[model samples]
Target: MNILLDAAQTAARLPWAPLVDEIEALLTDPTVQVPPRTVLPMAAGAFLFAMPGCDARTAMTKLITFTPANVGTATPTIQGDVAVFDVASGARTLILDGPTVTGRRTAAVSALGARWLAPNLAGPMLIVGAGVQGQAHVEVFAAALGVKQFRIASRRRASAEALAAHARRLGLRAEVVDDADAALADCPLVATCTPASAVVLRGQPRDDAFIAAVGAFTPQMVELAPELCRAIAAQGRIVVDSRDAGHEAGDLLQAGLDVDAMPALADIVAGQPKARDARGPVLFKSCGWAGWDLAAARLAAKSRPTG
Candidate 1:
């Protein structure tokens, strides 16, 4: 039976709360397998996924969260779909509208990093780029981390104000900001969600910070600036989903970094690469993975009512 996890049914619920424990459990266990993802991007849309094998069959989950931020602003932050198929039999068991999945799951991934990496990271947070990822970042942090203060910074000051107002309606202490460059310095954990051809967060903080630069996979697109990349590189470690994806990613590619030199996030999560040095900074660049979605799908699938 193909099950559809409707967005309306799941709204205003804590989707990622239980998964924090599941994610933690999955993190500690090494036996669980998620195969390398295949990504397809075009002017029309993009899809990313990985297959996590279980015995005779593997669960291949995909998330095609499109670039409809403009359209979704009137509707959802994302308008896409999610699916689960059998790796061996090639049989799909479920499909779901992905606005719910995309909103919560990516945030959970970032939250996992935030919980583990960001230390003494009290928030009254500041988010750069008032878009899908930016707003979602705030929700996951606030819901999971109990963030109290949230400052929204965007190119159009009006948009930032609108986002802040929408956020306040949800009861968050929020506001709009004119300068993203200024916001980065004070916030301990900065999540850069902007999608730009060149870096927007060039002057972002250098002070032993925890940064989740989650966008910019295309060779032409970038989120953080060269200076920010250099700053993080100089500070110490860079953790990625796959060295391959990070290498191909434009932001780091433009930074003149040897992508082959960086380690996979698996290693860091597994403790092969410690989260930080004695006292400096760390950069967690997520070329957001299929494995992450696979993890989230596994969590979401488990939440279904057994009838």
Candidate 2:
């Protein structure tokens, strides 16, 4: 039997701390399997993606489409479904709203990245882009890493203000800043969640800061500047969610980075040593991977009601 979960139900089942811990276990586990994803480009700025993975016990896949034109309409930019299956019986178990799985799992993965890269980060952190990913990240960071102060920025004042207001209701200190640079000025950590085709921030991040760039999955979109990429790469501290990021992440491509030279998040989580410039910032470029979806889907499936 297949269980179905709407976005609200999916979100309700995933609490940040345990969900983040599950992500951490997946990232650090050497046995988790994530195959290369498939992307099919469609005309007029739309693309279809299929991502599949397994956690030894269960298999799952996330099938999604990105349509840029949806932004102006009432539809969401990302739409699709995630299917979870029993490994032994090969029975379909659950189907979840793709956007909710994507948003929550992505933010959980980013939170894990921060823990591995900068475990001691106390906020006044800056989150650039006040959309769904932005709000999710704020909640994840606060819950997973104990970051309580945030500076939220968006091209529009209202959007930033809305996110900041939400943050304040959590008893956290949050402010909307007009200048992106000023918002990031003394931040120990920063999350760039925009879908800009060009670079968003103008200057380099603080030397001690760690950056999580969760946007810009396509080669055409770039959120981080090349100079910032170069500065972090110089320290040999760049990491990505998956090896496939070499093909999908625009921020890394725009930086002229050799994806092969960057370590996968799993490696970092497993305590594998990579070149590290101790004084430079660490960069975590996430091009959403299949394994995360699988893990999340399994968790959601386990929460299903039983007769």
Candidate 3:
């Protein structure tokens, strides 16, 4: 029987540690195959994304919609489902909520990057944007890295406060900051999760900071200032979650940085010596990848009972 998992059910199966481990394992597995996702423009500044991937044992596809216009509406900005299949027979095995998988898996990738690139996993991580991605990052960082303090910033103060309250319920210290740029000065770990066409975070990050820029996935969308991106490329190192980031990572592209030269998360996961060294602020650009969804599917399948 094919199982259907809603947002909450899907989230319960993908705990931070195991999901991160699955993603890391897939990074080095030669049998895993993930092609670049397809994004088509929709009406009113929205997008339809089809991401597919397969490994030796499992195959999955995530079909989701991105609607930036729904930011304040009752509807979520992202909606869809991830369909998992048995690789051998090509039989559908499970259906998981798309947004939950996207949010959690994306945050897991950032947490994995932090494991290798962060200067320190100390308190007071700064998260720019208080949307779903922002809250997911807080949950992953707090659970996986044991980060206890967070500074939340967003275009909407109420949203930031709400996220802060959520963090407090998780027994973490969280505060709403009016200025994300100012918060950058003290935070050794930072994540920008806003879906902004213009730069949302400006200025140079702390020298020892690890910044995960995960908001912008297209060449036109940008969250970090181009100048700051250039500064990081010049002084520190910029790493990407996938090579596809060369075309999708807007922060690096807008800054005219050669993303082709940046090391990928897979390279880091493989323990490449050059990718391990962090001389200055390390910026991890995550543009989303199908392999991550595949990893989530693998984990979700493991938790379910076999027929």
Candidate 4:
């Protein structure tokens, strides 16, 4: 059965605010064989996938976030769908609204990252890029961490300020800044929210700066320095949402990061390994796992009154 969910209705009933605990508990006791995202280039755009074996349910999705060149027209920033299956029966169960699910689940994943790794995460959070992912980051982090100060930076000052203004309207202390450096300096939990294939952020943190680089999916297209692999190699443990992403994610391989050292988010949450090294400066390279999306969505479904 292919049951489709209304984006608006599903989003409203997202249960995103309450899904954090389930996501955390999942990190502690995982039931899926999560694979890092895969990519297949299409003529118009490309498809990225994160397959979770059994995360409350068996789910796999191909998130097709398009190239910015296409955005010149009215092409959506991200558009895709998720196909969920039954573990025991191997029957197709649900086909979710991919584009909406991607934004919400990805945001939840980053929020979970902030909840577990960001140490002493007080004050100003700087989010680069004011796209769907960028906006989602702000929503998740604000809900996860009781942050007081927030700043949004985009290539366009108007858009950045708009996001800031939105946050403030939501009762969050925030503002939009034209300078990226100032945002990084003010906020300890700095995020790389852009997907552009270049080094973003004014610079990495001075010390113990927690970064969740949600941008930069391919090695050719990276948001931070290729030397970041070396930076984390030296200073802190470079943890990933999933090690499988290391192979699929260009940022890590391009940075000359070794997969052997990369730890899974589950391990960090499970106490299999410590969140950060004694030195500090922890890094989380997120390719946006399917497991997280499925995890968040599955839990959300449980909250609804099923027929």
Top TM-score prediction, candidate number:
3
lDDT of 1 by residue, 5-98 (tens): 5765433322656655556556565555656555555455443333333322336455554553453356553456667665667777666556
The TM-score between candidate 4 and the true structure equals 0.86
Q: Candidate 3: misplaced stretches above 4 Å?
A: 272-277, 304-307
Runs in model 1 lying further than 4 Å from the true structure:
10-14, 41-58, 63-79, 85-93, 204-206, 272-278, 304-307
lDDT of 4 by residue, 1-307 (tens): 2267656645653555666666776666546656655566656445444444465455555455555565425777676666666666777766677777777777777777767777657867888888777787788777767776777888878778788888888789887877776566567787777866566653556466677887766556677677765676687667787765666556677777776467777777877454544466767788766667767556645556233
Error (Å) of candidate 4 at residue 18 is 2.5
lDDT for predicted candidate 1 compared with the true structure? 0.65
Model 2 / residue 17 / CA error / Å? 1.2
| TM per prediction | 0.82, 0.93, 0.96, 0.86
lDDT of 1 at 21: 53
Q: What C-alpha lDDT, on a 0 to 100 scale, does residue 182 get in candidate 3?
A: 88
Alpha-carbon RMSD, each predicted model: 3.8, 2.5, 2.0, 3.2
Name the better of 1 and 2 by TM-score: 2
Worst 10 residues of 2 by lDDT: 271-280
Which 10 successive residues of model 3 have the least lDDT summed?
A: 269-278
Q: If the candidates were sorted by their lDDT against the true structure, best first, what order would they fall in? A: 3, 2, 4, 1
Candidate 1 lDDT for residue 55: 23
